[model samples]
Target: MFKKGLLTGVLLFGLFFGAGNLIFPPNIGVLSGDYFIYAISGFIVSAVGLATFTLIVSLFTGKGYQELMSDLIHPKFALVYLVALYLTIGPLFAIPRTATTSFSIGIEPVLANEYKGIGLSVFAIIYFAFTYWLAVSPTKLLDRIGKVLTPLFAGMIVLIIILGLQQLPHSPMNVASIDYSGAGKAFGSGVLEGYNTLDALAAVAFSVVAMDTLKTFEFKTQKDYKRTILFAGVSVASLFSVLYVGLALLGNYFKLPDTFKGNVGTYILSEMTQRVFGPSAQVFLAVMVIVTCLTTTVGLVVSISKFFNTIYTKFTYITYVRLFCLLGFMISNFGLDTIISLAVPVLLVLYPITIVIALLVCLHQLVTLSKVGIRLTMGIVTILSFLQVLSTINGFHYFKTVISLIPYHDIGVPWLLPAVVGVALAIILPYQKITKFKNNAEEKK
Candidate 1:
């Protein structure tokens, strides 16, 4: 149990700690500046807390994402939601972004202007090809990633943190930025920043991978497997929180105008390593980024392909893997900016629904919320999310203003009240007793 839990925890960490994980928190740190602690406190809750909650709910379901959603919402919605979820995590945005991030941070800076495009093209091919090879066989995923790659990844991250701390001055030199002026706004910004990591969504998608890997351990009962997942989830949450704090501090250390400019968290990391340990450390940083990105890419491909093949078995799993990998490779060549720009709108719509689902799933286990309540809550949140999305389009200024009035709306999470109302309506509707009484009557017959 100990060994399996340790390995599983590391695997979960690897899957969660990908391109965004490496880049975003540091930027958040710089933005938060001297208020890094207060801001990251909020960041950790939304980021790490969300992932842990997702994993625990998945464990309780003892099933992958399919049944988890199907039980709560209509099966039809489950199918549609899962498809969108998989696509977002797999080829459409995430998979390509990994390659682009790795290229921009790891390879792009080192190359001259003339060679950048070709360099990324060549890198994408090699990266996805290797990801395909690993993902082609999902059963060996634990052996390849959990037992091997994750430790190396974890080690490098730790080394980067340690070396970074060694370089910090006797005191902080930078002033707190106005972006995080007060604790409330700072905390809110941190919470919003967590969205960039997308671990909350990935946790659900990766639950399938975790379940499949757990089967190999041959746990005697479902309860045991869930217990193992709980252990792993705790470990993952703890590790991620620590790393996020460390990375943010490192970002704060490099908060000077020249170093902290633009979306260059990776470059900041590389510069930090080189300054502390010498130019040789840049190789270590690049290798670490590549491995972390590669592991995450492989896991996403495996999860997407395996889930799809199960539903549409006409194409073998490997074939789906190859197809997805091909699509990812093609999309990756478009570079990071394009992938991110396209992703923002979709994620804005998707994340609210995902968060509501995670919350409802956990809430249901503790309280007897009716199915109607769950459905209503999701429906209301979904509609509000759509309204929010539509407001971004042309001629919707009035709608956007209306949504912005919701509590915490300015921070981009306006669906909380709607979700609460959904639960309240579900409670007041009398649907639970009606459904129960109807079931009892039918059983008597």
Candidate 2:
């Protein structure tokens, strides 16, 4: 049980820890500056806390997140949410961002300046080609990502963080905005930055993969398997906490100028490698980034392909895989900056709903919410999240005035209070016979 749980945990970490996980810590580290500890504490709360809990919900319930949502909400809403999440977390955004991010920071450093576009295009093809190759063989995923890439990626990240920490920062911390100037604000900044990593969404996508991996092992009872799965979630929380702190500290150590900045996090990391390993830094960092992104791309590709194929049997798994890989290849060529820009609005809307769902689901285990409660709470959050989406656009400044009335809106989470209100309202509302329900408490959990 110990051996299987530990291995499963390692793979879980590999799936959750990629792309945004790679980029955000240091970016927020620099942004947090003197208050990094406070910032990272908040970061762990959202990133590790939410993701671990999300994994646990699926693990203990023995259901995929999409399935869980269907059980909790209307099947139609669940379908819409699942498809949107899969699109954002798979082909449309995440998978391609992996290619663009790896190329921008990892490969482009070694490319000839004039051939940057050509370099990105070439790298995208090769990167996705290898990703598709590995993804086609889903059976090997645990060995390839968990046993091999996870350790190698961890080693490289640890090497850079440890070495980078030995030297003091090149310059003072970057000036933070009003939202990051104090302990509270710094913590909020960290939380919001962590939220942007889009990991909680990945937790939902990857949960089935972990469960499927567990089925391959022999367990005496359902309880035993559930226990092992919970252990894996805890392991991921522990692993991410350690890595985020170290990486944030590394972010604190390097300060690059504006002219030199590409992706702030990537450039700062590139600067660290140059100082530590000199001329070989580019190749080494490139290898690390490639492995980090590859591990995730393979995971997302396989998970979504299996999911789409199952949900809509009109398309074959192989057909979906090819389409996703090809689509990812096309979008990645737009570059990392463009991809990030496109993702921001979508994430803003979807993440709040995700958070509410995760929170409600976790709470459901303690005491079941009536159908009215669930619907009302989700309704409030959905509206606010859409408004947040609009708030990010031009000529939407007026939305801020209304949003500002909400507590903690400054740090980008305006939905939190409203969600709480919905829950309270649910409790206050009259309960009807049809609203009565029970939680998914299988096997005495």
Candidate 3:
């Protein structure tokens, strides 16, 4: 159990630690500056804390997200939610962004200016080819990503971190990228920044892999299952904390120029590494980014494809994988900026609901809430999410103003109060189990 648990934890870490994970912390460090301690504390709450909560909640249900969420929410809603979730994490945004980021930070800097476009094109093809090769076999995934790739990436990352620490300046510049005038505001900003990691959502989605790995290890007893999963979550969380803090400190130590500001996590790390380790840092970071991105991209492809094939049966898992990889490869050429721009609206809509649902899942036994209540709560979240997204557009300044009036809306989550109200209303309303129509597939199982 110990050995298997460690491997599963490492695998989970690999899946969760992608380009976004690598980029966010250091930027937070740069932004928070003197308030680093307060900021990182809040960052960990939403990043590591919520993600750990997600894993624990999924373990309780002992089922994939589809089954668990479907049982709680309507099956139709679950299907739509899942489809959007997978696409956001897969070809549509995360996967492609990984390639683009790797190219921009790791490869583009070293390439001649004339060859930037060609360099990105060639790199994307090679990157996705490797991803496709590794992801083609689902069972072999653990062998490749967990056993081999993750360890390699970890070792390299450790070396970079060690080198960065060795060369750390005696003092940080203590510059504030943003006005973190108070601990409360700094913490709130940190929490919002940490949302870019998307670790919580990945934890929920990857619950399928975690459960499957446990089954493969032949842990049948419920007690053993819980123990092993707890170990894995702790292991992943510990490692994430170490990496996040280390990277953030590295960013502070450097005090990079204003030219590198605005989504400069990759630049800070890359430049710091090069400064510490010389030209070799470029090669090392490039390799690390590619391997890290590939592991995550492959994991996304496998999980999404497997889920789709299981539910729809319109295509085989491999077929879905190929299609996703193809799509990811095409979109990757759009570059990191474009992908990030696209992701904002989708994430704004999805992240709050995900957080609320995961929280409800965790508190399921303690709360006397019906499915209707939960649905209503999520409905409020969805409406607010839509409003939030709309507020991002040029013509919706009024909506943004109104949303800003909500408590914590300034912190980026305007839907919290409405969701709470929905929950309160549910608890007060008459208790009733609204009978849901189960599909033929669900009936067979």
TM-score for each predicted model, relative to the true structure: 0.92, 0.94, 0.93
Candidate number that wins on lDDT, 1 or 2: 2
Worst-scoring 10-residue span by lDDT in model 2: 432-441
Instruction: Kindly list the per-residue Cα lDDT of model 1 for residues 279-328, writing each as its tens digit.
Output: 67757767888998999999899888888998899999888999999999
lDDT of 2 at 52: 87
Off by over 4 Å in 3: 261-263, 366-368, 425-428, 434-445
- Note the clash tally of each candidate: 0, 0, 0
lDDT of 3 by residue, 15-39 (tens): 8888887888877777777788888
Which pairs clash in model 2?
A: none
Q: Work out candidate 2's RMSD over C-alphas.
A: 3.2
In Å, residue 387's CA in model 2 sits off its true spot by 1.3
Order of the predicted models by lDDT, top scorer first: 2, 3, 1
| lDDT (tens digit, per residue) of candidate 2 on 56-105 | 88778777777667667767888899899999999999999999889887
lDDT of 3 at 46: 84
